[model samples]
Target: MITISGLTKVYESRGRQVTALDGVDLHVREGEVFGVIGQSGAGKSSLIRCVNLLERPTSGTVVVDGVDLTALAGKGRRAGKDLRRARSSIGMVFQHFNLLSSRTVQDNIELPLEILGVSGAERSRRALELLDLVGLADKAKAYPGQLSGGQKQRVGIARALAGEPKVLLSDEATSALDPETTRSILQLLRDLNRQLGLTVLLITHEMDVVKTICDSAALMEKGRVVETGTVGELLATPGSRLATELFPVGGAATGPDRTVIDVTFHGETATQPVISQLSRTYNIDISILGAAMDTVGGRQIGRMRIELPGRYEENVVPVGFLREQGLQIEIVEPQDEARGAAEGEQAEARDARQDESQIDKQDAAPAATAPALVKDGAR
Candidate 1:
């Protein structure tokens, strides 16, 4: 429900201009979790902040559900009544939780309602419902200092939903948690997406987060979006950098005679025994160098690097056979010299075949030269 066009963000630090976002264009559909991934300085943080107008764009439009937030706030850093009213429908969860030290979990969740002039009874009731929604019902009275990192994030999520926003912007929301906790938080987000039909736009440096929860993803580099698509689409795309980053297959050294190929398996193909079928059909030994396989969005997706017995020229048919089975194959190396020599040999064989054809034609014709040689013997 969020559409961003030509969005740019620039800041000045120490008299030097820093561009955090550059002509970014993004669309996040309603009721889906979209992820933005990048390294430290790729400006993913700036992109998400601009979605909710937490950071004003240098130019361009930020439209959510047909409302242009950039126009509502005017061209300034301050938040006017119109902007704040618009922001109340958009929830933001920070990496640091951003909870008040003196506030209990319930109080923290109720803070937004309090500022919105909600009645005390209604605020308490909504806070309790949200705490239960985030599975933090028992921690309602617990202070932020008494909660664990994951628990604190749960409080943050609950507080963000306190306004019953149609959109949720998560800025590295699970970056501070442990692996197990991260999975739990991700599952929580997934559940929330299904239950509340909340549209999530999350930015993270972790590939696992995208793999585990995101339905669609964008890869950012140096303030530019280099790649974006559904997880399966990205995996099926040839030479997709995001696919490689998401499913990393290690490289192994191979002898000159061996051919290495990377095969991508998606959907039902991931469960197929295509590798074994190739070995049986070609009677050639196959070695797996590395494999990265996982289930994304309840579907199997994987990449496997394998080595075949002979060079690519000898195994072209076998690779084609694998491709016929709906597997995406990429040759990691090409034996150029060997292929050239083979082509030369084929050319020589073609010349020899032409000479043999001429001799056969001469033999089939009347043998005049044999008759001349036999005359002396007959006399």
Candidate 2:
């Protein structure tokens, strides 16, 4: 379990203070795979780094497994003995497989134990065990360069687990891999979470990662968490940004006097023919504009945008009837249709600009200035 409160991280760039995290408050429950998703500059990377005290927070408290890491960190630039000990139980996997190039897969995994003063025999045994656990037993003798990207990541996961950590922090662990590899990695994380009871807190820009493996998720924007909740709760929430992004049904009322409504279906309601039932029961023709369906955490979820033959006032009875059948509905106000369309376009343009700016900043930064771990590295 992990809890972060009032977490803020600021950096000096071009003689100006840039806030990477702005008062982020988040909680990850025990044994749950929690995901933090955002675009570039949303502070996801900074938040994960702060969790392990790799990047000390400008102001905040981080508590992991009931221990206040911020208090242990104190005012020191480097982590003290207490904080180091605490970090041993918190494993981290990086975007780039930070494995030692010269070390074999087994050696990379054993390095963490070696630093902890684990005996040679015990380290060897543990390394082999972890390799087997990560399905890399046969690749134990392979060097980092010899392995594929997915294999390298598996080695990284094995290395992170060498300490037998209770929590796993993943910083874009699958972003470098292809789609198939990414799915495999997400499945591996899910398997690890269930088998080892590891509480995973991963940060990614990919939505599929969250939909596939995360039980709960938080959406970040402009260095702040905008939405956080269980997948089910979010899917069932009316006008949920996460839900809309996850299952987008895009269409608007094409003509005046027609009412457009967005409906969310989940749990038992997802299986029923709610739309057909509504139409038949109300004796009204429903025109479906768009629909999307997907399964999350083994439950089917969907959203639909439909157009009714009348204004919101005229369709009130039918909308109420749909609500009675346990569907979340949002009536699109006809008066604000044009304004909302313009605002949506502007938001999209703004997002594109922000993304381009962040990419430029990243490209301009020197590789040598990138953060590196002293010991117990990702690999």
Per-model TM-score on C-alpha atoms = 0.85, 0.88
Candidate 2: tens digits of C-alpha lDDT, residues 1-379: 8999999999999999999999999999999999999999899999999999999999999999999999998786878899999999999999999999999989999999999999999999999998999899999898999999999999999999999999999999999999999989999999999999999999999888988989999999999999999998888787688987889776768889899999988889999988899899889999998899988877888899899998888998999998999999888776556766777799999999999997787677687644543232454
Model 1 Cα lDDT, one tens digit per residue, 125-194:
9999998888888988999999999999999999999999999999999999999999999999999999
lDDT of 1 at 240: 88
CA RMSD for every model? 22.8, 8.1
What candidate 1 gets wrong by more than 4 Å, as runs, is: 334-379
Q: Which ranges of candidate 2 are over 4 A from the true structure?
A: 335-379
User: In model 2, which residue pairs have backbone atoms overlapping below 3 Å?
Assistant: none
Predicted structure 2, TM vs. truth: 0.88
Query: Where is the poorest 10-residue window by lDDT in model 1?
Result: 333-342
